[model samples]
Target: MKSCREATRLMSESQERRLQLREQASLKLHLAMCAPCRNFGKQLSILRGISKSYAEGGPERTED
Candidate 1:
């Protein structure tokens, strides 16, 4: 099993889909067994999602 720190570090530098799968799996495993790490992973995921939205323009789309 990978440590939370190690998993988080991998997540930080990971970009490709395959790398993300491994990082996310490690993160989830740690989070499932550790409350603190769960919070940490949740925050990181939320932050990443928010940042991605902002990078792509934080606006709602409407169908015409």
Candidate 2:
């Protein structure tokens, strides 16, 4: 079993690149029992959506 720290690192890395099969399997197994990591994964998805929208010109930022 992977510790939450390792699992979370793998989870973050997965966002940028594909994880190995064993690593994916381990992350899946850990997330199956870990609520916090699962929530983190959801948050990552939300962030990705928001970022995509921003990249596509959904909004503009201005200096205060």
Candidate 3:
């Protein structure tokens, strides 16, 4: 069995557009069986939602 950190790393490093269906299924399977990794995924999702909300409402900062 993979460590929680290893599974979480694979989940995070995976590309949304590039991920195969099997890869996604595997990640879900791992998360379902691993409490720590599941918690990590949940927190990551929450943080992503917050960041997206902030970016949509906050002033735009261009780096040009």
Candidate 4:
């Protein structure tokens, strides 16, 4: 099993390009078993989507 550090690294790296089949398998296995890492991945995906929205001027988020 991959360590959290390694898993996180792979997660980040995946943003840039496609991972190999082995890497994909390892990351999937790790994310399945690691709740924290799974949450981290979810949050990362959300943040990325929000970032794209901001860049595209999709909407303004009012601060209160």
TM-score for candidate 3:
0.66
Clashing pairs in 4: none
Each model's RMSD to truth, in Å? 4.7, 4.0, 6.2, 3.1
Using TM-score as the measure, name the better of candidate 3 and candidate 4: 4
Please report, in order, the local distance difference test score of every candidate based on alpha carbons. 0.72, 0.94, 0.76, 0.96
Residue runs of model 4 more than 4 Å from their true location after superposition: 60-64
Best by TM-score: 4
Question: Candidate 4 on 1-64: residue-level lDDT in tens?
Answer: 9999999999999999999999999999999999999999999999999999989997968989
Tens-place lDDT per residue, model 3, 1-64, is 5577777777677624456787677777887788888888878788877888898996668998
TM-score of 1: 0.56
Of 2 and 3, the candidate ranking higher by TM-score: 2
Q: What is the lDDT of residue 51 in candidate 4?
A: 94
* lDDT computed for candidate 2: 0.94
User: What value does the lDDT take at residue 60 in candidate 3?
Assistant: 65
**Model 2: per-residue lDDT, tens digit, 1-64?**
8999999999889989999999999999999999999999999889999999989997778989
* Residue-level error in angstroms, candidate 3, position 53: 1.1
Which 10 consecutive positions of candidate 1 have the poorest summed lDDT?
10-19
- Residue pairs of candidate 1 with colliding backbone atoms: none
Candidate 2 stretches greater than 4 Å from native: 59-64
Model 3 / residue 14 / CA error / Å: 4.8
